[model samples]
Target: MQELAEVRLTAWVHGHVQGVGFRWWTRSRALELGLTGYAANKPDGRVEVVAQGPRAACEKLLELLQSGNTPGRVDNVVAEFSEPGDALSGFVER
Candidate 1:
């Protein structure tokens, strides 16, 4: 079978994402989707997630990020697509 082309999604999630275990939730979600990337908190009270994997998986991740499982409310998820960097090995919370 032909290998699927990799893609990247850089997402910024807003709304109570900083203190509601959003990072952990993101990491778990990404791992379950077989994605590689990092999730971290921004000083401006947002959660930043970078996911690299198949295009479909990355899109799924964006959906998950928008519907966050954390106790914090998910106000929005702004995602940008780009060529995969091929730099991540596994999902992690940064």
Candidate 2:
């Protein structure tokens, strides 16, 4: 059987993500999904996130980013594969 490979992904969330408890919600969901990463607001008015975990888990994370638990406007999502690293121990607002 083929083993599931761990993947690191960088997601750029654009829209109204700040001041809406988006980081907290993202942290909670990432932790629940067994994903390790961090979410922060970029200087250019975008939410930047780096997540690392199993492929399936990462996919779920992307899905969550697209459709938040409550409701938020996400203009676009720019994601790319990244190299794994210890960026965050827990979800944090930055």
Candidate of highest TM-score: 1
Each candidate structure's count of clashing pairs: 0, 0
User: How high is each candidate's TM-score?
Assistant: 0.90, 0.85
lDDT of 2 by residue, 4-93 (tens): 677887899998888888888888888998988889888887889888887778888898888745246788889987656765576666
Clashing pairs in 1: none
The lDDT values for all models are 0.85, 0.80
lDDT of 1 by residue, 37-59 (tens): 99988889988999998888888
**lDDT of the structure predicted as candidate 2:** 0.80
| Residue 51 error, candidate 2, Å | 0.7
Q: How many backbone clashes does candidate 1 have?
A: 0
How accurate locally is residue 69 in candidate 2, as Cα lDDT from 0 to 100? 53
